[model samples]
Target: MNYDRILAARTSRIKASAIRELLKLAANPDLISLGGGLPSPESFPLDLVMELTEKVINKYGSAALQYDTTEGFTPLRKALVEYINAKGIDAGLENIYITSGSQGFLDAIGKLLITPGDYVAVEGPTYLAALQAFNAYEVHYAQMQVDKEGVIPESMEEIIQSYPVKFVYTVPTFQNPSGKTIGVQRREKIAEIILKHDVLLIEDDPYSALRYKGEELPTIKSMAPDNVIYASTFSKIFAPGLRIGFFVAPEKLGRWLVLIKQGVDLNTCTFTQALATEYLTGGYVSKQVQKNINLYRPKLETMLKELEDNFPKDFKWCEPDGGMFLWVEGPEGMDMEKVYKRAIEKGVGFVPGTFFFPNPGDGIETMRLNFTNIAEEQIKQAIKILASVVEEEMKITSIN
Candidate 1:
């Protein structure tokens, strides 16, 4: 039972994510959690999945249940090739590699490319899990600035040019925590910078299909195919439980990814891949995505309206066109760590923003609120409680 002594040096180098630690508190039924960026279970197409499962059994039978290639089930790869090409990216089955989820793809990339002390550029408040994945490999990270339009181009250029970055990591569409999309022009600029400087780019795009308002922007991969590694997931569109995701890498890089995957899981679930192949080829995915958008748009609108009405005027927050979360920043000098503790005691919860940053203490005044998981009334009440906590915290800080 002496686990501490047995743990490896790599394990000792990493700490548990602060947001994940907070999520454990959300288990209490009394808690109104705006914490985790979780999709609503109501949005999942359970009936369609049941139908798809039956179809998979009827069509593939024993083949669906058998082991698959590390490169993924062939039909699924073919379907994804067509899907990405339809989105205007020139892709083929050869460029695609399927994994358990987009998170798995991240891990594979870390395993293939990262060496200890290799510099990685990321949006200042990036996805915490990506940082965790890279950190496990002992990679160093440099933060890029993000504005309303997402990662700032000039900041990205500065970092890319200055650091010998292994790859520039980005969540171009509806970025996690911030909920901001990188504009089309900025996307082009990013591509140009990466191509000109010969730095690799990793585009993590899971929320592109969930857009409720903005015009679709071309992925960075489309702009500079040779330099960008594109990643997407079925979790946001179809179902997270399926654990299916795919990545598009240049031929050489993709070969390495496939080998890394073989060592990791041998392959993703054979049955699930067969089911997803049917779902995509049968035209169910588009409809499901639209259904998700329709369900979440009103919830997002309600949360934004409530925040405007309830929170103090000085508090700034992002009004994301689409995505599961909104980033809220309290007035200068107000620490979100303290605010989060107070809000939890009052029966509401949110992820404090510092957890998303590669460097802690940088986003101390902020928090990320998820609108997709809770009902409208719960959102209203949670925001009201959060507003009260903000006021109380501001008062306490002012007195000090």
Candidate 2:
């Protein structure tokens, strides 16, 4: 009955997510958690979803409940084609495919392309879930340097030059963990670099629609359509429970991903896709996104103000244009993990940033905080508690 011997060798590389475990601690009702990147429950259009449910069942009838193609629900794919085209990426029905969520594409891409020991060039402090997905495929990461503007194009090019990377991955706009968005010029440079090297890049953009301020920037995929695979999800603007995500890729890669997905889940949930199709064609996205912006913008501003007024000057954080999270970095050799532990004891929670780095012992001075899930007053209270914990930790570090 020893399952270790019967399990696949790949199981060794797939460890439980540290953040997932941390979230459990944050689940206590008294804890004010900034640990999760969860969209606000307030952001979900609950009434509209119920309304759409009736419309979908009435419109599609038994088709809504039936099995669908491995590629995806066709109407959803067609709606997404227009959705992305508005972003300036030139794509069509053939180029569109759906998955259970963006997480599904992450795993599918890793399975479709990576061989054991193959290299993947990723931003130094990248999306932690991506590392989780690729780990199962036994892929090694070649870390890229990042600045306030997100991944440096030169750093990505250097890694690509030095390694036989299967593909390059990026979350260019309002990136998770860091809340850094690459500027348009950098996006152009990244596009040029990918084209120059003839490399494939994955542009995972789930936050662009959540813009609270500033003009919308062009996607890297728009700049290099042939070279980048663009993935997005309804989790932010819509409901996460639906678990609906989709991607646009070059025809050959798209077909291969579809083939790979067939063995995983025959198809994504048809009922949810039908609801999303109506959500799109019904023109609910713009209104829902605007409502989210109105709700989150003030929380973001409140957190920034609280940080400025309460935290030590040496402790700096990213001023993101739009995103659910903020990245805070303390002075050198200052461990945020210690601060995280202390903050939790005080009924406030945030994620230590080191786990986001593919390399161990990096980003020890950093942490990520989520603003969208908590209220403005709670944000004020949580930051005050967190700032106090950080100050105490700094004093201890200084004494040591």
> Scored by CA lDDT, what does every candidate get?
0.90, 0.92
Candidate 1 stretches with Cα past 4 Å from truth are: none
Model 2 regions more than 4 Å off:
17-24
Ten consecutive residues with minimal summed lDDT in candidate 2? Answer: 15-24
Candidate 2 per-residue lDDT over residues 315-371, each given as its tens digit: 889999898889999899799878887888899999899999999899999999999
Compared with the true structure, what per-residue lDDT tens digits does model 1 show for residues 1-400? 8988888777754867566676676677889999887899999888888999999999999999898899999999999999999888898888998999999999999989898889999998998889888888988888999888888989999998788899999998889979988988999999999988998999999998988897888899999999999999999989899999999989899999999999989999999999889989999888988999999999999999999999998999988888898999877798998898889889998899988998878989999999999999999999999999999998989933
- Deviation from native of the Cα of residue 32 in model 2, angstroms: 0.3
TM-score, prediction 1: 0.98
Clashing pairs in 1: none
Which number leads on lDDT?
Answer: 2
| Separate clash counts for every candidate | 0, 0
